[model samples]
Target: MHKTLSVATRLAAVAAVTLLGACAGMAPAPVFSQDSLPDTVKVPAGHRVVLETVGVGEITYECRAKAGDAMAFEWAFVGPRADLNGRDGKKLGTYFGPPATWASNDGSRITGTQVAVAPAKPGSIPLQLVRANPATGNGAMTGVSFVQRVATVGGVAPALPCDAAGAGRKEVVKYQADYIFWKPA
Candidate 1:
């Protein structure tokens, strides 16, 4: 009886260890990955490029526009954005947690042949929220389907503080994208 009890105890310990290993090896959360495809963006006008980053909470875009264009670099850590009716209310992340960036020429008015805006990097979320329709004189709005590829969020695409950056900002990994926006013809 004593030997049988000892064997049972050992088996239980082994089972517990196996269970723990399985839990620890669980797949990573749905947080966006660096290889994740980027959302599509359309160039809206003709002029020079202006970097535009839209972030919420601590998640911010690590971005740059055409090289040598000082005005081509801009990033924003936005708090929140709402519409006139205020119907869709979601978490700050749900709205802009995935750090996405875009660019427009100074004289751009939001209409033209769209071009590739930027390239994905190691620690970045490359995205382009192209407002398909430029404001029309008739006050009409036509939005394009959020494209995923030509523009993307390609960094440590954090889902939320609870995601890959919760331990601390220092512990979080950041990816930078190489953007390529040329003048529109």
Candidate 2:
């Protein structure tokens, strides 16, 4: 049963990779060069974030601020886990990046891409901020301390398990993450 569960998880993460493939083109940017900006300028780079896909499930993403000016950033999916697996290790749960897809949002909505597969493969996921109609934020992706969630639209969610159900599709349960950016004074 444990072996089956592991296989299922792998399959799920693969599914997620396929899903992000559709949105691959719209992915944001990658990590900036070491000298892109001054050492004093701290931009949101790589940070683990928990995000919900509303009706889908919860997802964990390594949210990184885009190198240049962007309303969003890159995400590295980590896969998902559930409160408790059902009889067949199948249950409503969350999925994170396998290092394939990345997700992000504007403290409201979230989205991403699968640069690689298996939340911890060997690549990064793309992400962006949830922007309203006509996003009007600065192109600069600022560094931030984000809280990912499996549910809760306005709350910060935590990270999901790596070897739970649905590791392939890596579905995020719902709004359960929070991200806060510290403005430079």
Candidate 3:
């Protein structure tokens, strides 16, 4: 019975590893370029390419009072989560927060402002043009000047009816997008 239990445990571990490998293998390759960016994501005249990360995350929303008469669900701009990955399917870091931050594995971090937006589809979250904060870390994010989020998928919250009774109700919606960083040429 001891031997049989050990064999079953080994088999389960092997199956788990195989499943993880398959998921990694199925990650899509990065496929966008500077030329493919939409006009809304305007890179300044002197900025040059730095790096791009493609990954998936969530966009959170909460029910809040709109104007004076009604309650509506709107983006809370915080608490969304994403795993930023490299072309080889290795995780490099994470993207999160209301101001929208990309924190890299090398201890570098940066935040950006949404200067422009173009909706990905009818209901999906839009691709965005973001202006980066001055680089503060001495890692991959050093000297970063601008960032663009494009080729997004998912991340839209359901259109549930919200009223005064539902104020403060929160929901997390799933999403995906490519984040491209740039620096002055």
Which has the greatest lDDT?
3
lDDT of each: 0.33, 0.32, 0.79
State candidate 2's TM-score. 0.19
| Runs in model 3 lying further than 4 Å from the true structure | 1-31, 70-79
Q: In order, how many clashes per candidate?
A: 19, 69, 3
Cα error, candidate 1, residue 110 (Å): 17
- Residue 181, model 3, lDDT: 83
Q: What TM-scores do the predictions have? A: 0.22, 0.19, 0.75
Prediction RMSDs, each to the true structure: 20.5, 23.1, 10.2
How much is 131 displaced in model 3, in angstroms? 0.8
Candidate 2 least-lDDT 10 residues: 114-123
Worst 10 residues of 3 by lDDT: 69-78
Model 1, position 142, has a per-residue lDDT of 21
Error of 1 at 10 (Å): 86
Q: Model 3: per-residue lDDT, tens digit, 1-185?
A: 35455888999999999999999889665444667667887687888777878768778787777665453444344467899988667899899886678899999999888899876876777788888897667898999988888778887766887676777888888888888889898
lDDT of 2 by residue, 62-175 (tens): 444444735444444455422322223333222243421222233221123212111211222222232112212332123323222211232122244333132333323333
